[model samples]
Target chain A: MKQKNDKSRAGRRTFLRTAGKAAVAAAALVGARSVGAQDKPGTRAAAGPVEGYNWNEHRWAYGIDTYRCIGCLRCVEACKAENGVSLDAHHFRTWVERYVYLEGEETARVDSQADSQNIAASGSEKEYRFDNRYKDKKVEKAFFVPKMCNHCSRPSCVQVCPTGATYKTKDGAVLIDHEHCIGCQYCVQACPYGARFFNDEERVTDKCTWCYHRITKGLMPACVEVCPTGTRIFGDLNDKESEISKFVRDNRVQVLKPEQGNAPTCFYIGLDKDVS
Target chain B: MEQLFHVAPYTGYVYPNETVFPWTVMIVVYPYLTGLVAGAFTVSSFYHVFGMEQFRPVSRLALLTALSFMIFVPYPLLMHLGHPERAFNAMITPHITSAFVAFGYFALFYVCLLVLEIWFVFRVDVVAHAQNATGLARQFYRALSLWSDDTSERARAIDRKFMFVLAVVGIPAAHGLHGYVGFVFASLKSREWWGSDMMPAVFLFSAIISGVALLIVLYITIAKIRRVPIDEACVRGLVYALWGFMMFTLLLEGVEFATLVYKGKEGIDIILEYVAHDLFYRFFVFQFGVGAILPIILITYMVFRKVRGKTFITVAFICGLLVLLQVFLMRWNVVISGQEIAKTMKGLLYYHVPVLGREGLIVSLSALFGPLVLLWIFTRVLPPWLDRPATAGPQ
Candidate 1:
């Protein structure tokens, strides 16, 4: 009887998830078609939602192990190239934040790869690097935390979008309907994670869509593929033997700003109090 | 040439995406203008809705002010839009969950209501001019009258009934639109500075004070310009209204600020630092001290001491000007200052207003004061003066 009850609950979950996916796929189809976006097959941002890819079969999620990150910033560079994000200090689809605690300081001093000092060190916004500001100081603790959109289940950006141009997918991705976007940027303000940015050239808000086109085609996101230390992880949550499921089962996992009630799909391991 | 983007200077660990502010000074003016529109409507309703005799002198002027300002209210939002061509998208495919869905509908409905009310109020004059004038002016008046030249008591009775009903409905429509603007900010839980239950009330009360204050300045200035006698009774009535609304604005603003501080949520430390340092002069010194409190004190003194003649006009005029500045600063503090406090809560950013370009200082000023240009034209065309005849007929 208990097993039957469990099976029924799982069935309900699948039904609701399928409905959400159908709506997303329909909207994406309408948006892409209306915009007349030319599909040059094999690109990360292929014109429309991928054909023959069933969103109902997969539940996507991301995981990060801060302990393994070395602040290499290769993932940042790779993400920009793969997603066609602007090469500037202010707009980043993915970034690495380094938290340093020197002796006698109770609070950690956090800076990202886009920090002005780091930008000056790298000598170009095209390349990404972290500055060596605290190398000589006696460090109490240090760690590099990779950051990206959490693709929250209850995304504020989706809620506040006046035109319904930005939406969250059933397979776990929050994406912008660029063609329909009025470019008010209210979504940019509503995002607590600061993951969304305004695309000045296009006059629209842009963000990391978890490389939707690649993922739908069964390829890894650019950041996950390039991480040297296996710091960033991406996998299907539905498959019992998937890496993300195993990672969740074996370790103590946490999320950034759980108090925000965003219900983020991105799980983190070894997150410090100062990470947010 | 246009600058594609302007990055704000920041300190500490702000999100890289936060370098460029989403909302600009034009957003600040958007709410400020809406506040004045709502406030001015409330003043007009004092005569129309509640039948206050003291308010009769400026009632027509008040309605004209509301209409003129309401017409230009959407100008700033359009100027700040990334795609001005798609400005109607919110109206066409408005997202239901979004707080912004009702704004376009509400503004359009309210504008229609205002136009209808104005038409009823001025139908007699339009008919009178249509019968007496010649050539272009005659054509204009005839068109304005919708080709009807009825001046009978029965026709006017229907006009009075319609005008009163429109004013009764307009009270909620105007105030609701302005309050909804506050709800837009309050609904966003991302920014601690904006997320508050009292935000709508605060915006509504401040709007009332600002509108009443504007009426004072306009009433006295227009009288001086046209060389007409200032109606002491009307000025006195408006002063009482301004003073009363000022009390609510101060209390609500003070309580809201105190509650924000006392709650001391996750980002309270940063909010405190921002309030003390970055927002000190614009918020504390000028907005609270000069704009709100000072006017209350001066008006109270005038009311009790029975300050008469030029002294009464001078005091009321000064208070009106100060409150207008105060409300403008209040909007700046809410819209701009709220954005300055980063979402990270670990840093703050400073936005530099540009002198030229679309979202620049010049464009913002035009959006702010352009309605006065429209108001001047509206007054010439409609002539909303109760005591004097409107552009006397040929007879």
Candidate 2:
């Protein structure tokens, strides 16, 4: 019986290794090289689906409803309070972008900037001024796109870290372990969306954790809680009954740069065309 | 006169409105490669300048590693640049005010130094058999001499003068080449992580660590392949050099951290928060924990016990590989993490590594393997180390 068990274990190991190698080879042959590097299912299976450690089982994702967004700037304020984000103009955990388009009888104009803090001051009158014309009833065509970390499912930052400093938690929320980071900055370059940021104090990398500390305890993320218009929605994406899941399932949702093949978990329902 | 003076208009459209290759990426590959070059050159200096006799076997190997890697320094930057063709502008009409201006001169000085040293060392053999070489080898060796008379007396005189001069100048060039790469990132004002003054020193020291380790591995592999007796004494001395560099590097980083944490700048706090809890595992575990500390411990044990065996050297080689990997991670963290903080001060941008893709592990492995292949090709024709001592008898 002992000999049989040992033979079975050896056979299993060989079978798994062969299967893994074959999968990698097939991925390469298909020209989707990125698919090969993802952690094999067996590797994930080894963790035994422990709570918080089983990332897929406890997915934490966010949805933003562009229609409901009031651009009140409350979420930005809340993010600062929670993350101890710097008050300076150069650093922000969350910010708003305003795109103003001017189309006239003879000419047209468009302007956009990523850092816009005083968005609330622009009332409906000012909002309509650009798109409104007395005769033609056209003024400024403008809208706001609040930008933050997408918390992608296949984060480029996590792939390039040689030390495994950046990882996805069991709940499918990507997080970084700062203690192991050596301040090398490989993840920064790997990111297609410019998400990762380096911390100056500890000489290491830092970025959004999807509020892992709060979300794991069943608290809404700071951004979601402070959003006065309920524009930002956060919940377990895996649960079909969760508001985020329902919105995504009901609406025509879009992920940024699907061509890049990151399969970003963050979804924007009613996303603007100029957002990316 | 009009035709002669009519250069292309400077619309500056050659560069894009926004760069696809980010600053963080440039910072990663540039300083990392430069560090490796400087480190390798320093290992060569141990034998040539300081006459650390035990390190003599790797002397040539060090020079070749330095030379080959130096060739690749321009590749990453060129690939990253919006108008790669305009790279020559740095040499032609260099902006004196720009810090990068020094890089052009640095490359020229070191290239000249390496050329002179290699020529002086190999001129006699080339002259004797210049006719025997075929194709590129013949052309290369013929061009290498630059039509100079390769007589016996002149060769001896040239070698003597060059060996001494190169030993002196190469040391400073090695320091400048790598240190200045660090200075590029260190000089940038926008990035908080690179703003520290200690970066250049840290980069230079780390360069030495990687360079020495690389040379040791190259030397051992070459010896085994050539069927030559492995020089135990040389291997031992190289380990000492590795240990020495690692010691200085560890101390320097510690002091840098202490100063950074103590000052407690606004940026410093945010940086520390991410580095401490987020990057802690990588910094403390792989880089310091396994890459640096473990090797140092093993080396110390060998040093203390006077243990001399192939196993000790192999362990050192493995440690050296780890050190290089550690430094690569160090560059990654510095470049990526620095940008992870939200520049607008609201929310951090999360970076996820792309699953297997062109820009993923394959490219990184290719960068390393590319150099190794170049080194192999370099050895076949150039023969980085002296197999049979030229002065042993009469060739």
Candidate 3:
């Protein structure tokens, strides 16, 4: 009787092992099939429709060369006209800023937007024309950064938004779905960049879109297109052959508040220290 | 001009301008949190000061509201702060000169005072209530009262004496606690929008308005939800209070506006342009029309015309929502408008509208939703009105 029982136990163990092997084989087949389905039509490894599009793929960035900007306000004008931005006190898609830093032995000045009116009014092509005391030089520096949304990879505005009204596109661009937005302005507070503005006319908040409409259609942003000196370089940084990619790779790049952990996609090649 | 920016090669470690977000958020959240504090205390004052046994139904709820709101008070400021991690530094090495430093101290003292006062108020009942409470709540109230079984005459007398002292101290602490936020804005020399002695007074008065409004709304809503009969007389009295405070707030705002437009101070003219043309929708449409004027008219009509029950409560609720909007817009105009003017005041550029991708509407709406959810969930665990045993059932 003991021998007979041992034989039966061994049979049961072998049967159980066989069943487990069969389940593992089935799972592997399903996994391989799913991977194959995801792969590109031509390549075996082109797994199914690019399983999750990388956010960096859709990002369109613009880097302005402070040296090339001549304080011409054409970019501001172009942005306003192109975006139908109202001149009301509450609606600004983009704007220019002038910064003045006082240092010994050197006086420097720049404007993010090289506007003809600002340049003509200041009457000098260099830093001295903007500052009266720096005429011959005693160390005064002034510049404009032409600030806008940095379109960070891990945007705080997107993270903290409760309604998911603000979202990042696959190409690393941050855009607001106005239809979904409830005009709470919580994102305005979450953002360290202060890039947000509440549009009283629309009863919704607005900010720079990186000219998403223009860019998706294979055109430059309004600001970049209007710029005369080609100071603003707009391109997909992910494209290694793109001008923006080359500039960023060749020159040291800096982003605003790197410690903030937003990992901004927009990289400035020759950004001013005071303006960052 | 054509001059290039030559500094030490930029390593991107520059100090970015503190986003107007933190200030805007703080202004709204501070006032809202303070409103809850004042509202909770006002409810408690009826029992403590007036010796109203009828208010026992709401006593615990009020104390709970005060504590919860106090916890959330610093959240808005933290979200706004450039260095949120360094927020605790203000407490350890306080800048005595800054109004915020004083606000931090006041918040601490106010919480302690509220806790002690609550202990005294609920000392006897806590033990009785503990028999019914299970698990965590039973343990909580037991531990909270420090297991003191003092039923003696001297213990009661001591508790009363301590409570009286705390209540007396609380009045100034509460006033300073919320009023100091007003002082923070009023003290800003750079901001013409907030540069007014009247701001602190306005803030305090408006706080009273919001406080009463919130209590009335909470009381009515809770009564309705629980299918309990509300104290009609209290609701009527609260409506009158709302009318009186709303009128005061309106008059003050009118006077401030007149002074600004008439005096034509350096920054006032520019502010007028923004208010009249630029910010007309938010200022007139939302803040004044819907927020201040509409509610004022409705509540005034209801109070004087002897409107009763749900109609009056509905009007009062609308008034509360409107007043909240008024406070929110007031903060917006003050914060955003102050920054709209260029540092040089020569470059008058409009504000940039934030897209959803950046931190704009999403984060703010979430913060707002936080309090609402808390208030709702709180009602489930703790009744809004105090549950009183019948005369025959208990003493």
Top-TM-score candidate index: 1
Estimate, for each residue in B260-304, the C-alpha lDDT of model 2 and write its tens digit: 778875445456666777778877788888888998999999888
lDDT of 3 by residue, B1-395 (tens): 31111111111121112222223434465666776576567656666666666665565566666766776777766654433555565566543443455666778889889878867766665655555578999887577558766646787778777767776676667667777767766665444566677877777767667766666767777778778787776666666766788888778877866776787755454566667776789877987788789988887687679787777767777787777678667666656655554332222334443324222355567655566567677554443445445211111
Candidate 3 residues lying further than 4 Å off, grouped into runs, are A1-276, B1-22, B52-59, B134-137, B151-161, B346-360, B375-384, B390-395
lDDT of 2 by residue, A131-222 (tens): 22223545555555555667777665665554565676667666666545544454554554555545433345555566665565566666
- Model 3: how far is B395 from its true place, Å? 7.8
CAPRI-style docking class of model 2 based on DockQ: incorrect
Tens-digit lDDT track of model 3 for A151-247: 9898877765445556777776787755445454646645556566554344445677877765766666767765655556778877876757765
Q: Where in model 1 is the C-alpha error above 4 Å?
A: A1-47, B390-395
The DockQ for candidate 2, computed on C-alphas, is: 0.02
Ranking of all candidate structures by their lDDT, best first = 1, 2, 3
Lowest lDDT 10-residue stretch of candidate 2 chain A:
A1-10
What ordering of candidates by TM-score runs from best to worst?
A: 1, 2, 3
Lowest-sum lDDT 10-residue window in model 1 chain B: B386-395
